[model samples]
Target: MYQGIRIAGFGGQGVISAGILLAQAGVEDKKNASWLPSYGPEMRGGTANCSVVISDGEVYTPIVSAPDTVIIMNEPSLPKFEPLLKKGGLMIINSSLINSRPTRTDITVVCVPCNKIAEELGMDRIANLVALGAFIKKTGAVTLTSVEHAMKKVYKRAKPEMLELNKKALQAGYDAVK
Candidate 1:
């Protein structure tokens, strides 16, 4: 497996949360993991990026200059992060917001209408989870069942009430991909 992953998007697109969940799952599976979130102009109607490292050995860098996978939720992030993904890496793009086609042919692209699915789920925020579910399926880096367990374990401390909704969101995301 590649040593690094990056999830980039807008502020409210849930990039940080998704990164957290992915990192937690990776660590739970006995892999060393690190999550780093960057916020600036990109966070406000611009680009936001989070680096998640999952490695069998100790992680060397928390910042990912080149990512093995990219999850894009907006057009701005598409261009910003497109070049950073390694050749032949997986890219899960939220086509609901990103209208442009990728220029890279080497990377495998999965364009899913995640915002539409989230809206159908009665919320427009779960698009990140949908993209993440597709990521899990394509990479086999983490399982949906394991992610569910991680979510409960992680969110239990801060927002115990979110347990059920997040579960539904993850399941909806997984089902949409299927």
Candidate 2:
């Protein structure tokens, strides 16, 4: 199986972190994975995105020009990445921040209230994790267990409570999808 994913959002929205976690999860699952990140000059509140490729065999490249799945975390990202999705791809939009909807009919769109769910979980920063959970549920690119295991490496300095909260956020996202 192979998945080319592009996750886009503002800088502080954990777009890069989410990509890292996904690639790490692939490693935890003993799969081939690569992550390439791009961002604007500003640190916070700037446009940020990452391309992640996960496959059971070798990964040909880290760049994903036409992604199988696109996770849009903000309003601007919707327009920026929507057209880059492969035909019949999946688009996971964070509806809490993005009010506009995609106009494309060739792809499937799943709108998740990522920020709303994260806030309900006690932190809005975990919205990316929530989105990740939805992606996992929809694509099965990697398992929840692998993602949790990957947190150890990606979020090396996280406290136990924070980890637990993250896990909860993921599960909530997963359950939210179906």
Candidate 3:
């Protein structure tokens, strides 16, 4: 199985981190994976995105021209990446930040109020994780168990409380879509 996923948002939104986690999860599941990140000169609030490719076999290239899935966390990322999605792809959009919706009918769109849901969970910064959770649930490209293991590795140095919070945020996002 091969899945190309793109995660886009403004800087400091954990777009790259989310992509990393996904790739790591793929690795944890013994799948071949690659991650490529891009961003503008401005760090925070600037356009940032990452492409992730996971497959049962080797991934020849990291570039993702047309992704099978895209997680858009902001308004600017919508127009920029929406057109890049493959036909019949899955789009998990953060409706709380992106007011507009995709016009395409060929693809499946799942709108989640990431920021609002994360805020309700008491950590707005985890909005990216929320989107990631939804994406995992919707696509099943990576199992939630694998993501949990990857999260542990990603936050290995962090405090236990923070790790628990992130896990909760992930579960919350997954539940939101279900």
Candidate 4:
């Protein structure tokens, strides 16, 4: 199966961490994976993107020239990546910030009002987790439990208290789509 995926959004939105979580989950499943991000100057505004690859064999390039899946969390991401998504690919969009829709019927798109949903939950920062939850549910790249496990591994050293709140945010995102 096509395993290359790209997640793009604003810098502070957690796209980088989401990419790391995907890579960690792949490692947990014993699959070959790589996570690459664009982090030079356009950190928060100009451009912010991450490429993640998960496969049964070794990965070649970390830069995803064309991705099998695209998770777009802002309006800018759509124009940035719509032309790069492969045919019959999948896209999970954050409906909270973006309004334009992908024109291709060959690709699947799932819109999650992540920021609004998280805001309603009293935590606007968890919007990233909400987007992550929708991405996981839409792609099934890894199980929710696997994502949670990967999350603990991600936050244990840096932000332990964030784990529970992010997990709850993920659950809320799941419920929003369900």
Which candidate number has the best TM-score?
Answer: 2
Error of 3 at 100 (Å): 0.5
Model 3, 57: alpha-carbon shift in Å? 1.6
Model 3's lDDT to the true fold?
A: 0.91
* Residue 168, candidate 1: C-alpha displacement in angstroms: 3.1
Residue 178, candidate 1: Cα error in Å is: 6.0
Task: Count backbone overlaps in model 3.
Answer: 0
Error of 2 at 85 (Å): 0.3
After superposition on all C-alphas, the RMSD of every candidate to the true structure, in Å, is 1.9, 0.9, 1.1, 1.7
Pairs clashing in candidate 3? none
Residue-level lDDT of model 4, residues 4-97, one tens digit each, is: 8898888888888889988897888777889998899879476588999988888988889889999898888898898899998888889999
Q: What is the clash count of model 1?
A: 1
Instruction: Using lDDT, give the best candidate's number.
Output: 2
The estimated TM-scores of all candidates read 0.90, 0.97, 0.96, 0.91
User: How far in Å is the alpha carbon of 166 misplaced in model 1?
Assistant: 2.1
| Candidate 1 lDDT over residue span 57-135, tens digit each | 8888899888888888889888888999899888888889989978999999988898988787777877888887888
Candidate 1 residue spans exceeding 4 A from truth: 157-161
lDDT of candidate 1 at residue 38, scale 0 to 100: 92
Q: How would you order the candidates by TM-score, starting with the best?
A: 2, 3, 4, 1
Model 2 Cα displacement at 110 (Å)? 0.4
- Model 3 regions lying over 4 Å from their true place: 42-44
- lDDT string for model 3 (49-111, tens) is 999999998899999999999999989888899899999999999999888999888999999
Per-residue error for 158 in candidate 2, Å, reads 0.6
Prediction 2 global C-alpha lDDT: 0.95
Give the lDDT of residue 40 in candidate 1: 70
What's the true lDDT of residue 83 in model 4?
Answer: 87
